[model samples]
Target: MGITIKDIAKAAGVSYSTVSKALNDSPLVKKETKQKILRVADEMGYQPNIAAKKLVSNESRTIGVVWPTVERVALTTLAAKINAALEQQKYHMLLSINPTKTAVDLFNRFQVDGVLVFGEEAHEEIISSSIPLLYYGEPGPATYPTIDVNRRKAIQLGVRHLVQLGHSRIAYIGDLNPQHSNQREKATGYTLGMEEAGYSHLHEAVDSRGLSWQAGYQAVKQLLSKKKPTALISASYDLTVGIIRGIKELHLTIPQDISLVSYDHIPEMEKLDVPVTAVGTPVQTIATEITNHLLQLASGKKVPPAILDVELFQRQSSRSPE
Candidate 1:
């Protein structure tokens, strides 16, 4: 059996009841004594019986994250941030890579305080649960409270920036699959931005067939084979990375040979060969917002759907076409 509070109490020279209070962080225990007990417990590698605690208090103090697409780097980063945020509020985060319905059902059985579902392209059948639910992505037909970033506006920001820089022949590279609503929204924004700039005839500039680095590389390679645009806007950070590689392989340079802008707000973009100009809601902000809403729901408070705004960060990758 794992080391228990009683073992910790023996090590710390405290009563079992005192150790239990200290473990629960009750104010009844003196601060110095509590700290001593905690240190002893840590040194002893005492693992608390969470199942027993849950049975006694009827609360697990845990949050379930249902992420169907765990492979997406952006989602992985956001989930990590959310985990940190939830930890700050003394809640443990449990990730489930199972199908959405299955994960929801499993979390319900575990009696987690709340559940957060990450959006995916796959349509999921609804599963009822008493646990409060929060969704992060396109609202769609979800009955749960959703927090969505303005992806269309994000793409528009990048497109408009290129337009302002006198890049009339602008191209967009992104996933064109009809089922990918988020990518579709960004593509629609690109069309709107192009139309607004009176470049409606340049519809051929948009390539909506892929979201991976290889897809971006191949898309750019194909574009170069035909007629390269003055500037290119990528729908995601991974695609942008591939675009940069494609440009390099073609003996082209950013902003000098071909200007580029990408979607998604991440600090790592700054470390690239050229600090990429990005447009989207910051991942940290999204994580914090989702965590706060989940906490509110766990407390039995109602939360309305939230739509986050996006912003453009102009960096070295974009400039007026030569």
Candidate 2:
């Protein structure tokens, strides 16, 4: 059979409460006695029931991750990394694909220590909850502590890199929805980059209907038909992939006919036939920051909204325009 606090208490010659405190590593327990009790508990193969402890302590040591948009492979990988990070601290992670309101309510009922929300698009309506909430993107009044990347800066960096390569005529392919603050910031960055480079004629904003390769293909094809850009700045990794396929279908080649840069931090993008020049914060870093912030809040430490720094990785997909 298994062992329990009662067995540990008997072996340590202490009360069950004392054994419980010692096993939990509570400061109230004497250190020497706690160590002795822990050693005995280990010998006896006693594992404290977290659920039962939660009933008494009112702390679950569990985090709820609300990621409604599961289509993004990059996001999934980041979430997994964050989950592993949290696991190191003895914190359990639970993910939900439910919408904001439902997810918030579910976490609330579960009495989770904190909630990490990842939304595809920013929302104006605030979600009121007693549990601490950390948003992964832009901040809304609903959540206080948010972790956002400098998307505009990243895109601007991409544009500058292409400009330095002597590409004067460049086009930007991005989703133009004004409600999506992240996309808007990227578009703004592209425009700022083009204008700053004194190549205002190259500023073409083709709207990708969605953040998919298909949307990218359709938008790029339309742009090529009207006016072919010598270089292209895509807003996301998926769009960049679509744009590359579209270009090839139209009998164009990377860095030969049309150079490309995109805003993403995906590993696979580098393994493409022509490595894509990507500008964004590393996924691991971003994921760790978000996870750390949530854990800090859970431990009653105050955290403020943060904007992560983006890194530009120059690759072979971009070169001087012919």
Candidate 3:
């Protein structure tokens, strides 16, 4: 017993075609007539059947976000950023936390205009999907377009910056799993930067094992117990929060005791007890780029893979070793 366009047309004393044009805001319908029709439609409690609408227009005007989990802090922030950008383009963003393959299948069933995948781990196992896809991390299966920050360059530059400040004993703390491509790139950057600076013997990389805040805090505590590094570079914002906690618990102060540099650019870094020096593309910049790529793929356009460079933002957390 749901209200239909015919009912609205009859109630508004107009033909069915005229009612349809007014409801869709077609330019052929006068503004006042459209407004009156809209009012009548609202009063009649008519809800749109999205599936039917999609069948007619061939576009859902929705973008599905396939995120592995909502537990990751950085992922949530980036999702919000992408959502805002999509809204501006009159596209709705929907999120799914299902496994990569499952999420893709679900989005396909829903018939979203496009799918944006966040890379947390290697997705080589994902099967080919017919829908347009744009990845925000490493390129996965199906040869879709991918855009990522240059993680290796970001970490390498962090190490070089610390070395230039006369700190030979700079340690890097992050995930050391070989299967995680992004973290491996960072680990490699730390080693390469050390070798390039002639400080390979003094280089130490602590394994965080996971990306949790607790992992960062415990990694640093164990690292401090065995080695004495004048400077430490923690990878990821969550880990940096834990690193600072571990340092403070030991009655040490940043710069005066141990200088630090983190490997992510976010506003939260500045709000910490000691504002952090960071290296990477700003979150806003990455978000905007990914949004644009997602829209392009949705329109059946191809975008070549992109690797964004990094920049260092010096702050209160790092200084010369005195």
Candidate 4:
């Protein structure tokens, strides 16, 4: 279907072996012949077969990313950042949105230099493979290398920021399923943060039931109808969007009627109708850390488990109760 070495040989009027030697720049081929064959190959737009090159060099210079869930917008930024970071190191990235095992198997079949799994849920497991694998998100296997963000601490920081602004009555909105480990971490942080602030009696939470924008919007509308908190912390970016929409529909204003803080510190937060105060290590920093560890893994260098810290970024969406 595409240009092939055989086609280039015919165009150059050379024997198959002669074309092969010239293409490889073999010393047996005369310099003029090699150049002529190379020129012909270039004219024909011949492209090297990755599989064939792997047989000779044993390195594909490719990284496969396993992204089982495609609906998560917050992670899109992180994935793109990682892609750019990998390109800086002369590595190409491939993404698979299939199930964990199937994606890993495909990457293994392709013989990519490594695999990075973008884990979303808790209690994740993978089949043992000869290829190096790394996880980002919730805890994976004990022996598996991972890049974990301190999500619980991220929420705690959000709570701390609101409490410092003199808001004792605060609420949290997010998925509360005990089985969902990522959401569980944020929920725990809210509890611990309230207790640490000595406002355990004022602690409140509304389960969004899901992480979608619609879920957040509905959850906030329901929560606000029953009770009014001076401030609210959201568990996700998508939920933050829904929360803002819900607040506006209720004729309430951010930081005037209610203040808000969100979980993800992504660029989109700034572009929202009301800029959001967010919690987490910036995706750029997370991206760089992930890229460095991936390179290390590809080089056969063992990487220790990493847990990145999250911090609060104060912005227009959160302030002292008015």
Identify the leading candidate in terms of lDDT.
Answer: 4
In candidate 4, stretches whose alpha carbon ends up further than 4 angstroms from where it belongs are 4-47, 123-126
Scored by lDDT, model 4 comes in at 0.90
Distance (Å) between predicted and true CA of 76, model 4? 1.0
Q: Which residue pairs in candidate 2 have backbone atoms (N, alpha carbon, C) closer than 3 angstroms, thus clashing? A: none
Residue 24's lDDT within candidate 3 is 74
Ranking by lDDT: 4, 3, 2, 1
Candidate with top TM-score is 1
Each prediction's TM-score versus the true structure: 0.93, 0.85, 0.92, 0.88
Pairs with backbone N, CA or C atoms under 3 Å apart (clashes), candidate 3: none
Clashing pairs in 1: none
Tens digits of per-residue lDDT for model 3 on 1-322?
6888999999998898999999878999989888989999999999776677799998888999998776667777788888898899988888898988999999999999899888888886755788898888756765788899998999999998988999999999999998888889989999999999999998799999988889999999999999989999988988999999999999999989999999888887899999999998988889899889888888888899999989999999999998
Model 3 per-residue lDDT at 46: 90
> In angstroms, how far off is 128's CA in candidate 3?
1.9
**Cα-lDDT of candidate 1:** 0.86
lDDT of 2 by residue, 1-322 (tens): 4677888899999999999788667999999999999889888888777667789888899999988677766677788889988898888998888888799899999889999888677765678999998888756564467889999999999889988999878899999999888889999999999999997876799999788888899999999999978899999888887899999999989989999998888787888778998899988788789888998999889898899999988889998887
Q: lDDT tens string, model 4, 57-150?
A: 8988889999856677788888999999999997899999988888889999999999998777764555676888898886667777989789
Clashes of each: 0, 0, 0, 0
